[model samples]
Target: MSDPNANRGLAGIVAAESALSFIDGAEGRLSYRGYDIHALARHAGYLEAVYLLWYDALPSAMELAVFEGTLAGQRELPAAVLEVLGRLPDASTPMAALRTAVSVLGQVDPEAEDISHEADLRKAGRLVAQLPTVIASFDRIRRGLEPVAPDPELGHAANFLFMRTGQAPGPTAARALDTSLLLYLEHGLNASTFTARVVASTLADIHSAVTAAVSALKGPLHGGANEKAMEMLLDIGSTEAAASYVDKALAEKRKIMGFGHRVYRTEDPRATHLRRLAEELSVESADTRWFELSRAVERLMLERKGLHCNVDFYCATVYHALDLPVDLFTPLFAMGRTAGWAAHVMEQHMHNRLIRPRAEYTGELDRPWVPIDRR
Candidate 1:
């Protein structure tokens, strides 16, 4: 029994006006700043997507080139930040490590206290540039391997992969990852984006707002869904088992990871692109197991439950085909989402307002307490 009158999760409430991204969940479409997401995911580079989200317009060719140089220039992490990453316990989750690393980055940044639009924009670019480095370095460090330095000549996705394995990614792999990052560039008022806006509403620095976003994304119902979804795929093991697993999981009243979204009434528009990318990568690697199994589950879920795959569904297989660890999936999410988080933070700062929502009281309205002697 629930109160029908109450807006239980603030599900339908419009919190603010934003021009960053738009979603027509009923139509299964998404766009950022008037650009179709399908177009961006298919053709735009991640850096280009970052520029679009931040600048409110698609950059001209020369602008994109200069933007690339500017963001790529900031890819190196502070040495103290590197030291912190190196000392974090091997058991540290990428999400936790990244959150801590971002906080440290703020302390080292001289402009961290500056919340002006110009300073925030610069900080945003720096964060987006450094996120992959932080995650890749942490991965290599925890594995007792020397971190490979960032390659300035490499594109964002390729540089991230290169920094991890000390090998430049091939065109196809790099494009797949770039497309995935572009697809994740923005979504309308998602948990992490909302968290970022809320913190920014208080006039917090970009780094502090982003750190809070990373923390919000650590929750399983949010960014961690892809990691859990991938683990579920691993547990299912093969295509033959996917249907039975889904059926059994449903019958037993268990939650299926990556099957639905909070906002989308139809399929997640981004999932379609990811499904294609996953298949391409799996075929390229001659490892079609995860991709095939993902399709099996996807079809079965649609047939049985009428639910659609969110952006995170096929993304599990896509990341696996790219050789990313399950645990790194969420941080990779945080990495891609940095663009949107920063954009939202800047937007909130531009229109400064503290986001204080009221809560309804459900307990007894009046109660009396006696003194200790009244026992």
Candidate 2:
């Protein structure tokens, strides 16, 4: 029998072993494949980070060039997929559209039924390449604009921005987005990653696993926090309003969207890089209100609640400064995290096991069954 005192939500439970990423919550440290996140965010590009997560090691220069070329080549979507995106209602949320689009991609993929490790890896590369394109295209289509084609010359982050806005991003803006992607690429057995692993363990194909992962991420407690955080900032509107808004929210016991985290006791390490990026982007845009307001809220939250900022808090300001639509924030999160999900899916497949856990039943021990016609 399972212990009655087993942790709720499986908190602190080590269900499976992985070499993909590790989180040291006590020290607020995170690493992917034994490489520190700070080092990757500072020194590596988004593609490089994705390569590391997928291949379990950083690629050499020649290897990286070929890998990047393959991804760029796969960026073009099938016409049928584009048509599906175009037909979706403007009222559709980006995450919902992405989920549907990914499902369609699975249906159309020639190799969707392939379950071999080599085939799964190829699919992973295709997903990493194609997700940004899908997201950028849907954003443009919903705005009644034609989708821009991917530029072969641009790297992943720059290419995404270019596609979304029909103009190439400046170096600073592109780099900021790249760093944010690195920060979001992977975490240790997060809800969506676990979802991916669970699905993969059932011997499902890569597309199915990724689709399941996307569904899990669409939940508010998982990927929707960043969108909520951005909404909160817009609600506050100014530095002067931030403290009192926070005070009122706190007095009413309202949950602050981005202040606390499930794992990190201190500040999220990803937030450290994002906070700086937010400040820098805000400065470059010559509108510092969002960053200043965020800082004021940060101060108040810490003074009263001792809760430090998580990755979502500063990313709201950063995305705002980049001129990204607030609604697309979670889809952007899905784009970055596709790499991690693919990696976990592959890893789970490599070491196959059905992830089945039992619940301690508490509702009825000896209750008599009631008939349908009972009076």
Candidate 3:
């Protein structure tokens, strides 16, 4: 018999055990392995965080160098993948293009059918290296420009900026981006991560799992929130209009994207760092309007709704200040989250299980079938 007390959307359900990340929702704390997120965000590089997520320990200096070198060596996409991106229509969204490219990568991978741990780790590293290239290539191609080749000398975050802009990022910009990527490296069983883990449980390749994760992330309620938040700011057009727009949105019961979270009763821990990045970048860019407006809306939302900002809220301004288009925001998220997704996939594969779950029946039981002629 099905339990009538089933949790809708699997709320409060512990689907699987993981050693990758821990979230204290009531306390508003997040950690990777046992390292606190704040400490990692402040002190660790993105690649270090990636290593920690994948291996469950921080890498030694020599190990990190080798890891970074291995990842950098894999940055170039398959020529066939680039050709595919070149042929995609200009209007194709970045997420769609990324999904297609990753699937194509699976097709071309030598060990595509290999489910072994070593092969999966290699595939994960390749994906981490190549996804930013895919995103940056698509962005440039769509704008009638050639893709910028990645600089091997730069680290992951800086290399991404260089690929996107064809120039090395300043220390501040690089650090801000590095911090953002580090902050987003992992979280506890987020929607997209769960999707990745679910696909992995089916014994799919890492690429397929990550491809499915990207699809899940394309939804507005997941990875698209930051892009929508940026749109809201742009729609308001000025700081002076922020309150009126927010008030009208509240009165109409429209969702104020980026202002709340499913798990965090207090503030999202990641938001604190992103909010500071937004402020820093805005000041450096000599345009504080977006950050100012974001703060205003945040204050109003809190006063009226008692909601706190999630990671997506201030990230809109930060990315905007970096001159990234709104559409690419989610792809950037996928790039950062690739590490976490791959980690979850690895974890799921290590402890294999089919993820099938029962649905509670709500319809008439054992209904008699009628013949078509009789009916």
Q: Rate the local accuracy (lDDT) of all candidates.
A: 0.91, 0.90, 0.90
Question: lDDT by residue for model 3 over 64-180, one digit each (tens)?
Answer: 999999999999989999999999876789999999999999999888989899998999999999999999999999988999998999989899999988999999899888888
After superposing candidate 2 on the true structure, give the runs of residues whose Cα lies further than 4 Å from its correct spot.
1-6
Sort the predicted structures by lDDT, highest score first: 1, 3, 2
> Model 1 scores what on Cα lDDT?
0.91
User: Candidate 3 — which pairs collide?
Assistant: none
**All candidates: TM-score:** 0.97, 0.97, 0.97
lDDT of 1 by residue, 1-375 (tens): 358577877898999889999899899989989999888887888889889889888899999999999888999999999999988887899899999999999999879899999999999989998999999999999888998889989999999999999989899899988888888888989888899999999898999999999999999898999999999999999999888899999999888899888889898999999999999998888888889899999999899999998999888888898899899999989999998999999999999889989777667856788799996
Candidate 2 lDDT, tens digit per residue, 1-375? 677777988889998899988899889999989999889888999889888888888999999999999999999998889999999986899999999989888888878998788888888888889999999999999888999999989989999999998899999899999899889899978899999999889898888888888889887788888889999999998888888899999999998888898899998999999999999998888999899998998899999999998888888889889999898888888899998998888888889999999778867587788998994
Q: Model 2, residue 112: what's the lDDT? A: 91
- Which of the two candidates, 1 or 2, achieves a greater lDDT against the reference? 1
